[model samples]
Target chain A: MEELIQQLKEQIIEVLNLEDVTPADIDNDAPLFGEGLGLDSIDALELIVMMEKEYGIKLKNPAEGKEIFKSINVMAQYVNEHRTK
Target chain B: MTHLGKIVITPRGVELNSQVYPTSQIGDALLTACYRSCHADYPKFFKMDPLCRLGFIASELLLQSQDEERFIPREDRAVVLASCNGCLHTDRHYASTIHAGDNYFPSPAVFVYTLPNIVTGEIAIRNKYLGESSMYIVEDGLTEEELVQRLAELTFQDPVTTSAIIGWVDYHDGDHYNAILYLIQK
Candidate 1:
């Protein structure tokens, strides 16, 4: 779980093009959007792709991501539980 | 016509020779490069608000070092942005994730950057420009006559339209972008 979270952090930085952020800088339980990471709607979409590519979870309705992506804790939990691979 | 001066920012570098910049990476490369060539230090004028792409470059050219006090509230400052794709680059990139996989839900982060006028908003925030602002996405390139007429109307009718930045920001691909800003005065 710890390794996966770390990988997710790295991926987020790369895909979102976060200029000054690094993987170690991201807190595992910190909010991924708004005040925590200062990410907007676009970063969320890129994260969606990261989920599919890294963990093999598919989300049919993009809207469903609201709750799932509330925080890295929620995303890691969801990925752990529903990952097909 | 409120012909001010033409400030062209292309991806390849400074376009002092009136050369057409290749239309690629219209989002970051073209916009940032244009702004960089016009200004010595790119960081001085760069704002990472995501919406600060085209208008940011054009406005940087017009304001130059006046950005510190640019928001002093001029009576005649208007923001006029015309782009073919608007913020579609961010939109399409976001959509690709949702469409690519079934469980991949759409992200709110990616969704907000889709608006065509976000660039205009960013410009307003950076410059504290409380004057008139607008965006137009035409099927083809905007007709010169139409653009000229609009400029005329803004300068004549609107009291807060002293200078304007009118141009096209079309990002059809990752490596293509084009912007031409005209800083007009009454």
Candidate 2:
């Protein structure tokens, strides 16, 4: 779970391009959006696609994943339950 | 009098950039290169209409400051973009995507970028600039002075057009693009 979270952090940093941020700076349980990481709606969509391509989780509606993706802990829990692969 | 300002040129795609993305495509490369050069994040841009991406980048460079609000005024600012292709690359991409499969005809993604003035719209939104805006199409390159003269004449009707964004955005199928922006001040 820890490794997965770290990998996810790297992916997030790369995909969303938080240029000034690094993996170590991200807290595993910290929120990824607003206040926590300052991500926005567009970042959310990118994350949705990233989740589908990398984790085999297809989010029918990006909005539904908002709560699940609030933090790495929540995202991992949701992914563990729903990943197709 | 010649409008005074700085000219910033950006070239997209290495091959095309050699001639600097000349209006003609002389080399072969993936279409993605065109989108990639202007943005570090491809998927984010791929999801957006190409015009939006072009506008965002161009505006970022044209405005080029955090305190742009002072330069871009509600009444004085105007936007003018000149392009030969005028979204032709995006149109071609969309046609191929739809032609390949009938089930999906309209690619909202590509379709939205298929406008000549989208760059202008994007500039307006990013800067919150509510001013006279227009797009011009030219068959061949015109000197910067000529472009400024043309734009000034067009915006002459507006009294407060002291500063403006004028540029040329042209892209081709071989993933080549050339965008030049100049901020004109009277």
Candidate 3:
């Protein structure tokens, strides 16, 4: 679980091009959108694509992302269970 | 028949308002070096594709010394830009993502910049200009006569358009780009 979370942090930073942000700066339980990461709609779409590319997890519905991508911890948990590759 | 400002950026270096900028500190990546030389603080610039970045930087240099309120109204200024390659480099990069059979992964970040007109949108958004904005993909770079003809047509077509930012910005492969922008007033 800890390893997955750390990996998620690194992937997020790379995909989003968060040039100045470090993996340690992202709190596991903090929100990934709105106030926490200040990410916009485009960033959300990027995250969705990242999910499919990195993990073999295909989110059938965009609505499912709202729950799964709420935080780093949530995303890590979801990927661990659903990833086929 | 008035000229406000002019800027020309090439792989060699940058020329702002007819004077060549010193290239002592500028290294291989001329675009990034020029952006840093301008001392622009806009973070969104980092996320833009090379074509958009070139257009944005050219527009910024042209409008930097002018008073927007007194000279050109936000709603009356038009952005008329032309490009040759028209985001071909970004398209190639995005295509690479889905090329492999087992590693098929399309990137949304790169896909968003596939359109040629997005560079015009970036300029409009940055300057808060609500006026006309258009991009033309020409086979070769537009000649001065062709650019003037287009500008004349735009000015005549839109009664509200009294000022325009006209230029040619082209980016190909990697590290090969050129942008020449002119601010003209009727």
Candidate 4:
């Protein structure tokens, strides 16, 4: 779980091109949107694509993103459970 | 058109009303470095394309003085941006993302900035400007006076326009980005 969380942080940073942020900078429990990372709607869409491209987790409903991308930990768990590649 | 303030940004650095702000990061880091030097707090700058980033930084620097005026949701304020390349770099990159049939992954973050006028939108969003906003793609030899003239025509044509932000912001390549912005008032 810890490894997955850390890997998720790195992947998010790389995919989102958060140039100033590092894996260590992102808290496991911090929200990925609105507060914490303060990402916007576009970032949510990017994350949706990242989930499908990187983990094979195709999100058909855009509303589910709020919960799935709530935090690094949540995303890590989701990826671990759903990733096909 | 009464010019309120002018800001020029190049790979060399920035010049606001003839005041120089030199930067050490000349090539890829010029825009980010300029953004930092201006103490701009907008984090979305990191997500913007080269064209939008160049224009966003210039607008921030150009209107930094009008701190109070910029924050207010002014309906009479306008933004006009000109570029030679006009988001060409981003369009090429975005095109590449979807070009392949097998590996097509066109992200909205990248695709949203595939237009030159998005710079005008970014400036409007940041400054809460509800007035006229537009962009123009011109030849390489478009003069500074001519850029201002284009904006002046709009300012006069619109009855509600009391102030405007105008500039030529272009990013042709990593080493050839430039933004010349002006804040104008009647």
Compare the candidates by lDDT and give the number of the best one.
Answer: 4
Please write out the lDDT profile of model 2 over residues A1-85, one tens digit for every residue: 7777778889888767665578888887788887667777767776887787677787787678779888988887888788786
Give the lDDT of residue B38 in candidate 3: 72
lDDT of 3 by residue, B7-80 (tens): 89777777889998765433236666666767777766777888988888888777878755533437888888
How well is each residue in B37-154 modelled by candidate 4, as lDDT tens digits?
Answer: 8888787888888888888888888888887767889899999777889999999999999999988889889999998899999999999999999998888786788767876886
Any runs in candidate 3 off by more than 4 Å, and if so which?
B22-28, B67-73, B145-149
Give me candidate 3's TM-score against the actual structure: 0.88
**Which is the winner by TM-score between candidate 1 and candidate 3?**
3
**After superposing candidate 1, which stretches have Cα over 4 Å from the reference?**
A27-36, A40-85, B1-5, B16-52, B72-76, B84-110, B139-149, B174-176
The residue pairs found clashing in candidate 4 are none
Clashing pairs in 3: none
Deviation of model 1 at A43, angstroms: 4.6
Q: Among the candidates, what TM-score does chain A have in each? A: 0.86, 0.90, 0.94, 0.92
Model 4 CAPRI quality: medium
- Cα miss at B63, model 2 (Å)? 5.3
Number of the candidate with higher lDDT, 1 or 2: 1
TM-score of every candidate: 0.65, 0.64, 0.88, 0.93
What global local distance difference test value does model 3 have? 0.81
Per-residue alpha-carbon lDDT of candidate 1 for residues B38-129, written as tens digits (9 for 90 to 100): 54343423324334455576666656645466767654677776767677777776777578565465655556567778777667666776
Quote the lDDT for A73 in model 4.
86
Q: Would you list the rank order by TM-score, best first?
A: 4, 3, 1, 2
By DockQ, the best candidate is: 4
- How does model 4 do on interface RMSD, in angstroms? 1.1
Worst 10 residues of 3 chain B by lDDT: B22-31
